[model samples]
Target: MRVLMRQSAFALILSGLATPGALAAGSHLVSSQKLDWETATKLASEAVRICAAQGYSVTAAVVDPSGHQQAVVKGDTVPLQSLSVSYRKAYTAFSYGQAFDKNTTSELINAKLAGPENGALNTIPEVLFVPGGVTLRKADHRVIGGLGVSGAPGGDKDEACAKDAVAELQGEFQ
Candidate 1:
């Protein structure tokens, strides 16, 4: 069958690639960490729920390590702008956190990039240098992604919701 032929061909390619130095002479495979959709959904929903419990309608977003949005949840009554802002915040936290070798919040990233020389980082479209953004990590401290919340009156308040959400789901990545 055509399907079996394709499978056999794929297996052959994989076996070849598995041999040492079989790939592109000097290049090698790269491994990355990421959150499954179910986990990302749980994280985003929990963030929004925590904020809603506080009488704040907010949006929460989770992004993969590569800065791709994994899941997003918007609390009832949250403004439309909160949606995109949430994603941007998550991207900023993940990207900057990886660069600094630490799980970071937007507040921490902002402070680290405060100097005049680093101001240009702000111009990056996906960079939102504010609180309410924090990197998500596994039990071994490997960052898998980020979470962000917005529309909670202040960035600090948003951050609290984000952190509480992570704490609530601590066992997820373990």
Candidate 2:
């Protein structure tokens, strides 16, 4: 009877009918990759440099997958508001998986795809439905974080700086 019960339980576990830890003496292992501080800072710095080269004083921010600020680089002449805007843009990109391609998050939001009525995404706090934000993907195409650049006179210019920064560090992504 005991042998039959054990076999049944084992089968249940194998079939995923039982809870994961029901028959396990140890914990399950989980692994995920995240952007390191060094890489985040490098990205921010590169974005700022790119914007400066284009004669745009901007603030660049990098955020993790959890929408936490990883690094922020503010140009000497950038306004204080740019800091918040840059952070919001980064958070939005990280939350929405938006890339800095031809059509940015801002454009889509403005086009009503993610308008205020659509889950009120535009009304979300700390989310800037604007361009200048780009998702950071690993070589395996896993999104690890996001970068945002603000105060570049236009969203397109800011997006360009952010895109250039990510392109420059393409090889460094794991």
Candidate 3:
């Protein structure tokens, strides 16, 4: 009886660890599909509208889970320089599966596993480290892709425009 009890306890411990890993893997797969084309279009429209309302011509970019650009939008008055940055922001978020923060997170990753030296993150050209880009979240709040808006007053303003874009697509996203 004592040997049987010990065996059962070991099995339970192994099972507990395995359960969490299985759940995490499943969640990751489901969250990835949230970066669909329909969502991207709606979000892009939303960003364009917000920037227009704010009197700032802007460019917006949406990227997939792998950080590939899905859609790009530029307002008539937007500067040509804004287009590249806008695309880069979206790519950054999609590549990292997180929002664009100018802080140490990017630096830390870039130093360790990114850039042309490492042959990873730096693979995408023109991705900016500015704060305007944010990761797109699914119903479960999982980061699926990202939206980036540039050519506004500043990075924060660009971020706001992206948020407004998400708001425009909130119904479909939900």
Candidate 4:
């Protein structure tokens, strides 16, 4: 056992693999920048206001260009359990660059592709499989992220809240 361990360590050192963590500590990762916190906060707040005006009492979530959470807000009336779904909805839109759609409700329900592990709609954990999330696009039509709203009486109403917020954020997003 001792001999095997010594040989393995020697082989790793010889192959320049002794410092595995050094690979992630390079300058490349340090130079990769992300959106500023202030901008993310502003966008999230605007979405919350839109949902509030619609009488939905929703939870709204915003993700960055990399599908990472920028900001999130849950209204007073929104249930605590819906928070994860709201966040995942935003993540799906950002990650997939598309709006949410009900899976089984559609006739084209190719079950193999429509599940969470597949490449179809509602394919992620906690993602609301409804039409209430919108992609945040740039002036050149590049998708930067997504905004998702939930807790409305109807899924359509939730979509409306998302649309309103996106419209209000047009100039800033550009």
Q: Which candidate is the best by lDDT?
A: 1
- Residue lDDT tens for model 3, 1-174: 979955654443332222344444543221135556766877886798888998989988887755677888789988988888888877665555443332212332554434555565555565555656766665655555678888988887887778767766766765
User: Could you tell me how far off, in angstroms, the CA of residue 161 lies in candidate 4 after the best superposition?
Assistant: 0.8
Which candidate comes out best when scored by TM-score?
A: 1
How would you encode candidate 1's per-residue C-alpha lDDT over 106-174 as one tens digit per residue?
A: 556555752356578778888877788888877866677889899999888998999999999979876
Q: List candidate 3 segments past 4 Å from native.
A: 1-31, 97-126
Better of 1 and 2 by TM-score: 1
Per-model TM-score on C-alpha atoms: 0.78, 0.76, 0.65, 0.65
lDDT per model vs. reference: 0.78, 0.78, 0.66, 0.61
* Candidate 4 backbone clash number: 0
In model 1, the clashing pairs are: none
Looking at model 3, the pairs that clash are none
lDDT of 4: 0.61
Encode model 2's per-residue lDDT on 1-174: one tens digit a residue: 979967876655532235446556443432345678999999999999999998999999998866789999999999889999999888877766633332345555666555455577667898777889887776655667788899999988998999989999978886
lDDT measured at residue 174 in model 2 versus the true structure, 0 to 100 = 66
Supply the global lDDT for candidate 3.
0.66
Provide the lowest-lDDT 10-residue window in model 3: 99-108
Ten residues in sequence with the least summed lDDT for candidate 1: 15-24
Candidate 4 per-residue lDDT, tens place, 149-172, comes to 778886567667777777876787
In angstroms, how far off is 78's CA in candidate 4?
0.9
